[model samples]
Target chain A: MLVIDNLKASINGKQILKGISLHVKEGEVHAIMGPNGSGKSTLAAILAGREFAAIDGGSVSYFGRNLLDMAPEERSRDGLFLGFQYPIEIPGVSMVNFMKTAINEHRKYRGLEPLSASDFLKLMREKKELVEIDSTLTNRSVNEGFSGGEKKKNEIFQMAMLEPRLAILDETDSGLDIDALRIVANGVNKLKRKDSSVIVITHYQRLLDFIVPDVVHVLYDGRIVKTAGKELALELEEKGYDWIKKEAEKTEESWRVNPQ
Target chain B: MNGNICQGGLFTLQESTVSENMENDSDKILDEVTSGDYKYGFYTDIEADQIAKGLNEDVVRMISQRKGEPGWLLEFRLRAYRHWLTMKMPGWANLKIPEIDYQDIIYYSAPRQKVAPGSLDEIDPELKKTFDRLGIPLDEQKHLSGVAVDAVMDSVSVATTFRETLAEMGIIFSSFSEAVKEYPDLVKRYLGSVVPYTDNYFAALNSAVFSDGSFCYIPKGVRCPMELSTYFRINAANTGQFERTLLVADEESYVSYLEGCTAPMRDENQLHAAVVEIVSERGAEVKYATVQNWYPGDKNGRGGIYNFVTKRGICKGDNSKISWTQVETGSAITWKYPSCILKGDNSVGEFYSVAVTNNHQQADTGTKMIHIGRNTRSTIVSKGISAGVSQNSYRGLVKVLKKASGARNFSQCDSLLLGDKCGAHTFPYIEVDNQTAVIEHEATTSKIGEDQIFYCNQRGISTEDAIGLIVNGYAREVINKLPMEFAVEAQKLLQISLEGSVG
Candidate 1:
């Protein structure tokens, strides 16, 4: 459902993703693993059409449509979702009102009628079960004083509400405990459909155990140096990226010798 | 050129005119009306019947005669005018007021084109259209829902709508001048009773030369059927719009009053000093709300209204309550403190204020609550927003007397700065002589954070929408306190007043 070709992105004039390319077909889960500062978050941010990220030279296409040209909200309406690494706290806007506005904005863009009050409340009740968000917190301001686990769970609850075609979980597992991680992973797993895809960006392989990926890629120094199947993540976790770095240097040397 | 106070007799325009011809002047008049920024410089071309320049007993007499007031009111005006001469300008407010030449200001100015309309259908179309441009129509039943309106043009109240309906409900809602003529006993009994002539400098000045304003009264055991509103407009140049509003709720009665004011742009600054007083008797409740959008002088502060107001209320009997809510967004220099007095046992006083100062405007406003009887209570919530090169401050006082046992007070003052050049300050004084009294105060200052805006944009909301959402949230507490019909309008007004605060 998506194709990212040689996508290179930078923020604040600092290159994050340097000519890294990837593709995930329909009904697939792709996990991109890396050490600190591996541009894993940058890839997710760029795909979600966030500001402050300029594409140096590359293209991102979703369902054969140019995704880079769409605004952040437009991308969401087009079924592109980004689970924030740190969710914002909007002090007077209740989560219920925020969700209603977001849903209506997307529906309006798609030339659909807004959900009735009863239907909206019904949908909210059904989504609450997926991530187990507290009803009291949902009635209060959006993430005004939510706990870390509650914030992460709220993100998954929102994901379920929007029901996007491609979901990018950026560091969603960082602040989650084992139980919370299981709950979030289970929520994401339940939302999977044959036409949808998931891109998980993490610094460790812990989250992958819950929802195993179909493909694994290692990003280092703004570029993906190696790609393999799910077993590669376990191997990298057992050994380290130092071996991958040395192998990448040798490959660069061979490329210079061949001059291709 | 000399630092001289034009002392002794009133500085008359006739004397200055002859002197201008006799002397070879080297210094020109400071014609800068815009306070360094001229936003609205377009003047409306309309003929006006203006009073002679300057303030004096003669000027007050002329205004009283122009309004055709009674001899009692004329004598009252003369007495107040004489008293104003002995008072000095107050320096407690953080405002740099210019020396006003009483004779140089035209006290009473009215449209010379038409006479007063006896009914709504007889009102001039041109004048009605003028009010329409200002977004308020004089016809009450047509524009306002479940409310009566009194439209004041220049310095006089032109017409009041829904009078008969109010009369049937035992409610008296009309202009102050009309009340002095019709309900002379009530006017005489209550006028200057809450805020007397010796209360303050501005109150004394307003009492002396105030031309017209609104007067409302709810009788015993009766509740007002609809909201009563008054709209004030200053269309004549050099004419200061001085208004006086009084609302009285009798035993077991309830009433709500709303007052709004706006003025057109003029090259010379106009003065708007008003006085408002309300009294709630035993078991009575009174609510007063104001949305002031007078012309705030230009950026450099050349033109705009000098709003010096004195507003107060008294809870005189047991179980009585009084509430004041104001949304002030305009004025060149504003100095006001709408206060309340809790005199009876179990009386309650509440004040909720939202003041915004933009461009070169300056506002120093807050409220005071004085507890006298036992078990009295008061609550105050103030929000100040400062943008451009403006300055806004909240200065308040909460005092509990020794006899005020078991008195309680809670006050919260918050300020929001929109730009680096602007400033916000809060000064709250609490004097509790009663050991049994309890008082709590909270103050906070915040600015529109760049990160907050970016976060909203990351969700695809525009910058303006984001700012609106944030401001609405900040003002939700006070907005929710307004009357249900007025809350929506007040919210929209907040958004428009804070426009361009966000980059």
Candidate 2:
């Protein structure tokens, strides 16, 4: 369903994602794990078509099409979603208006008529139940004056509303409490289908326990250093990323000595 | 990386800068949207009685002679004309007003009415077609069914409706000239009582050559059954527009009055100087709303209207209330301040405004609330939006006199900028004399960031619609104060005026 080849990206001429590659098929979950600044969020931003960074070299293919050629809105209409790590606070724009406009726009792109007010309200109520977000949260402006846990849950709520083909969740569990984490992970699990895929990018293994990944990859610097089954998460949890960092450094030092 | 010189071909891989391309694309879209053509720039052809171009004693006398006014009104005009000669155009506003050649303007012009005036047949079919195209459902049966509109075309009130029902209720609604002929005592007593002829430069000019406007009076203890409206359109080319509106709510009465305007596209800048006066008696309430959408000239600012006017209301008796709501979105240059004087103890006054300037348009507008009576209260909310290369400013004042013990006031002013070229400013003046007076004021200025636009983009909403949504949200507090019918139109106007002007 998705293919990223040699995605070398940089921001302000400082290299972030250097020769990163990944592949995912339908109905599969992949976890991209790394230390604090391992280009995890940059990968998600690139896939979402954010233009803050310069794509030094990349060729992303989604559904056998050149993903880089599409605009951000076109990517969204084509069923690509990105759960922002830090959700933006837009004052004065209510959640109901924001969500309705978003859903109606998606419908329009698919050659469908807009939903009636009553039907839209019903849909909102159903999704609110799925994400456990109450009426008070959605009645106000989008993410304005919301707590950290509420913002995370709201993101999952949006994912359920969009029902995207491929969703990249970046640090969705960072600010959430235990209860919020369980609810957010449960919402993601419920929305998953046979034809959809999920990419969970995180700095910890706690979130992986709820929505377990089929495959896990350890990223260091910019490259994928290791790819293994889900047990790699439990192993990394018991022991920190020190071994992986030391080994990666040794490999770089040897490369500098041998030029190979 | 600073590139003093690319001497060794160190970093020449990319052909074009990616971020530059994106920013340029957004800026291009903004340009195209803001530069969209004005839709109501069409003209009409009709036979008319137009006076010669110039302003002098003879021209003022000629206007009075043509209207066949009584000697007292003529003397009033002459007095205002003489005072106007002694007063120079005020330049205290934050505007770059061009020197206006008063003699180069036609003082008076009206569409000729050959037949008797009470029938619709007296209105020219050509003018009717234009009105239909302008979406003015003048037909009482088809459009604005409950609202009565005294249509003013080219400074002459041509069509009047809903008067008989109002007459049964002891309410007088008619054109200014008709009021002068039928109720000269009322007109003489109230006209210039709130905004006198010696008020300002433009007020003096309007008083001297004012042709026609709407006049309304609600009797004591009576409430008007319908909304009184006047749709003023500048039809004749090069004719200076002078409109005067006088509304009086007698003791224990209630009324809502609406004023709207639009003008045809002209090559020369048209000067529009007008005055509005409202008098509220004891226990009376008056609500006035305006949606001014005159011609704002072309995108290059070649031609438009220079709108300068004086509007004021006085709460005369105790416990009276008055509110003013205006949505000003047109004109090349606008300089107006609608004010309220709280002279009655325990009276209330409110002002709500939304001013939008796109292309080369400029607007310097706000309101003044003067608390003169003890326990008087006032509220002011002003919203200014600037797009394209335009400039928008809000200048407001709130004053409490020494005698106004226990007076209170609350004022809020907000400005939003759409593009890098546009500018927004706020000038608030506050004065308090009595120690018991309480006042609160808040001001904020904001710009639409690219992140917000991109977030909407990611949700499948286009940039244009996103801008509309965001702007409407920003101005919701003020737009909510407009009357329902005008609220919807005002929203659409705000959207259309800012189509692609923001990046």
Candidate 3:
């Protein structure tokens, strides 16, 4: 469903994501695990078409189309969703209105008519139930005055509303209590379809336990240093990332010596 | 949108590069909006009877004589004119007003007609086309059914539709000149009863040279069935529009009045000093709304209208109420305070305003709520949006006298800045002499954040529409207070004024 080739990105002359390559097939779930400053979130941002970081090299393709050239909104309209690690708080913009505008924009891009008021409310009710988000939260301004857990759950609610083909979840497990984490993960799992894929970007394997992944990759020093299966996440959780850091250091030293 | 937004999560710092891009995008939008074409700048060609330029006792007399006013009214204008000469222009507002040459402005300029049009067919086709272009047709059949319009061009009210029907209901709705002749007693009694000529500098000048405006009266125990509206247009060059509107609601009566103003584009500044006074008797209610869209000069702020207006209302009897709602989005320099005098026990006053300024425009507007009698109440809500290199400020005052025991007042003023070049300010003064009085004030200033824009952009909404959404949400509280017809116009004006026609 998505392929990223040797993606390179930087911010203010400081490189964030080094050369990185990854591919995800339809219905496959990929868990990208890393410690802080490993550029996991940066990779997710670049994939979602954020322009903050300068794309130094390489390319990203989604459904055989150049994803990097598309704008963030265009990417969203084309079924590319990025669940923000820190959901923004837009005061005075109701969640219902925001979701409705977003859904209508996507539908417009697909040459479909906007949802009628009743149809929109019905769809909202359905998504609300699927994500376990109450009407009070959905009725209020977008993420305004919401608890950390509620904000994350609202992200999932939006995801359920959009029904993207590929959703890159960035630290959905962060700042979430165990119950809230379970609910969020359950929402994502419920929305999973045979033609859809998910990239769960988290620092720990706790989220993966709820929405298990088909493959696991360890990103260290802006590079994907390890790629394996679900067992790799458990192994990384048990021993932590010290071993991977050491391995990354040795590989960097080798690259410096060989000048590649 | 980026890991930069995740630095500390929730509310985080933006990258300098990202902010630089945002700055460019915002600057571009500000440029576009500031340089936006004035859609109502088209001029109409018709013969106009104009007086010689300059302000003097004779000019004031000429205006009164031209209107064929009574001798007592002529004395009132002459007295106000002499007093205006003795007074100096007030300079307290937060604005850089250019020195205005009163001698260079024509005090009176009216369409040359033998008499007030006896019917719509007698009206000038050019004038009719002008109003039609402004979305305000003079033909009652083509007009909104619920609104009775008085179309004022230059210095005279051309036509006031539904007048006969309104007369049947005992609602006196007609031009000021007509009212002075038909209901001389009512006009003389309530003309300066609410806002006297001696109230301020502009009030005195407007009282002296004001040529034409609308006059409305809702008699005892009657409610106005239709919205009474006045559409003022400055079609003649070098002429100032001094319109005086007087509205009186008798005991147990109710009325809602709307006023809208526009002007053709000119290379020289035009002066518009208008005075609006409304009075509500016992158990009566009055609502006054205005959508002021005067020409706001060019991109370089070369020429526009100097809008110096005085608008006030009085609750003259117990249980009476007066509410003011205005959406001001034009004028090179705007200075107005639509205030209320709560003189009766248990009276109420409310003010809801949304003022937007772009380019080199400057606006310093708010309201004053004076509590005089016991148990009076007032509420004030203001929203200011500043874009380009403009300056927007909310200056308001709430005073509770010693006799106003148990009085309550709440005021909220919020300002939103669109770009770094623009500015927003709030100045609120509160005085409570009564120990039992309660006053609450809340103020906040916010700039449109890059994160907010990006969030909307990520949702497939353009930056312009995002700003519109945010601004509309910010001003919803005030816009919702307008009458149904004005509320819709206010919303569309807000969108077009600041965000442009994009999206």
**Which TM-score values does chain B get in all models?**
0.89, 0.94, 0.96
Candidate ranking under TM-score, highest first, comes to 3, 2, 1
What are the candidates' individual DockQ scores?
A: 0.11, 0.38, 0.47
Report, for every candidate in turn, its global Cα lDDT versus the true structure: 0.80, 0.86, 0.88
In the range B80-141, model 2's lDDT, one tens digit per residue, is 99999999999988888999999999989998867746666466777778778777756667
Instruction: Give the B-chain TM-score of model 2.
Output: 0.94
Off by over 4 Å in 3: B1-21, B29-35, B113-115
How should the candidates be ordered by DockQ, best one leading? Answer: 3, 2, 1
lDDT of 3 by residue, B1-503 (tens): 11222234522223556567556765676566544567888898888999999988888888888888899999989889888889999999999998999999998999877665789878877788889999999998888998999999989999999998899989999999999999999998998888888989999999899999999999999999999999999999999999999999999999988889899889999999999999999999998988999999977888999999999999999999999999999899999999999998999999999999988999999999999989999999998988889999999999999999999999988888888898998889888899999999988888777667667766777667677777777787888888887888888788777755633
Docking class of 2: acceptable
Candidate 2 residue runs with Cα over 4 Å from true position: A257-260, B1-26, B500-503
Candidate 2 per-residue lDDT, tens place, A49-68, comes to 86667789979999999998
- After TM-score superposition, the amount by which residue A204's alpha carbon in candidate 1 deviates from its true location, in angstroms, is 4.1
Candidate 1 wrong stretches, greater than 4 Å: A1-27, A36-39, A42-79, A107-132, A193-195, A220-225, A236-260, B1-47, B96-101, B112-115, B133-135, B266-268, B297-302, B500-503
Per-residue alpha-carbon lDDT of candidate 1 for residues B1-503, written as tens digits (9 for 90 to 100) = 00121221111212344234312211111111111232223345677778877887888888888878889888888888888889999987887788877677787887765766678878777777877776677776567688788888777787798998899988999998899888989998999999998898888889888988999999999989888899888887778888898889999999888888877776578888999999999999998898887888756767889999999999999999999999888888999999989998999999999998877889999999999989999999998877767899999999999999999999999887665667899999999999999999988887654334434544545455566676676677787787887788777666666564321
Best by DockQ: 3
Classify candidate 1 by CAPRI docking class: incorrect
